[model samples]
Target: MKKIEVVAAIIQHDDKTLCVQRGPAKFDYIHHKFEFPGGKVESGETGEQAIIRELQEELRLDISKADYFMTVDHTYPDFHITMHGYICPVESREIVLTEHIDAQWLSINELPQLDWAAADIPFVEKLMAE
Candidate 1:
């Protein structure tokens, strides 16, 4: 199985977290599912750097810094993933979605209502538990 290293930003602003819906994928399980905004980590890039760059590229959202959060390791039928989560505080919820189909800023309490990708569920659970 292929292993992927990814970073996710739990972008927060005005007491809401940013969730982005993925576009169509080869796998039905993940397609169109909501997820924390981020992408894969490139070789030689730190997890923080990866998140910062990914957010800039994917959402056109600039974040000065990201605090370290928890890491989640999950395996799907096709691939395995080790995801690093970050707590990124932003000034605004505004974003230009270049990759995702839709985006939402929902309170922690409301996060569970969305259909989320399996890999992202752990992050949601942790956030809602807080």
Candidate 2:
């Protein structure tokens, strides 16, 4: 199995967390569902670097700073993945969604209502529990 490293961001603003709907690439399992914005870490790239690049590519914003929040280790039949999650605040609200089919800003209370990626469930639970 291929070992993959991914970075996910739990971006928050004014008590609302940013979530994106899965696009075509992720349409099979829970298509169009909410998830934290992130992608696989590239070769020779750090998790932080991948997250920053992905945020810029997907949201069109330069991430000045991001804090590591959680790390989730998951194994699938096809691949093994280690996802690192970060929490950060963007400079503005003008997000240009280039990859996601849809995006929403939901409160922690609302998180439980939406269907999230399997690996993201624990993070959401943790956030909801706090």
Candidate 3:
């Protein structure tokens, strides 16, 4: 198995965290679950750079800064992924929604109600604790 690094942006505004519905391609693991907006960190790209670039490309907004939130190492049957999660406040409200089917900002208290990706459970717990 190969190691993959992913950057996830956990943007929060007015106590709501920005989440997106995973695309059809994610059926293997996440399926239709909701997740923080982000993606894989390409080779030679720093974690911060990956988050900034991914957010810009996926959401069409300029991310000012990404604050480190948590780092999680998750293993699946086929591969292992290390995710660097960040909480960044969005400067622009405009989102392109290129890959995801839907997006929304949900309150921390209501996070448990949403069907989230399995790996997101720990991150959401940390967010709720804060």
Instruction: Specify the highest-TM-score model's number.
Output: 1
Task: List runs of model 2 lying over 4 Å from the truth.
Answer: none
lDDT of 3 by residue, 68-100 (tens): 999989887667888999989865556789878
What TM-score would every model get versus the actual structure? 0.98, 0.90, 0.92
| Superior candidate under TM-score, 1 versus 3 | 1
lDDT of 2 at 9: 88
* Ranked candidates (TM-score, high to low): 1, 3, 2
- Weakest 10 consecutive residues of candidate 1 by summed lDDT: 121-130
lDDT of 2: 0.83
Error of model 1, residue 16, in angstroms: 0.5
Across 32-66, the per-residue lDDT of candidate 2 in tens digits comes to 66788888889999878999999999888677788
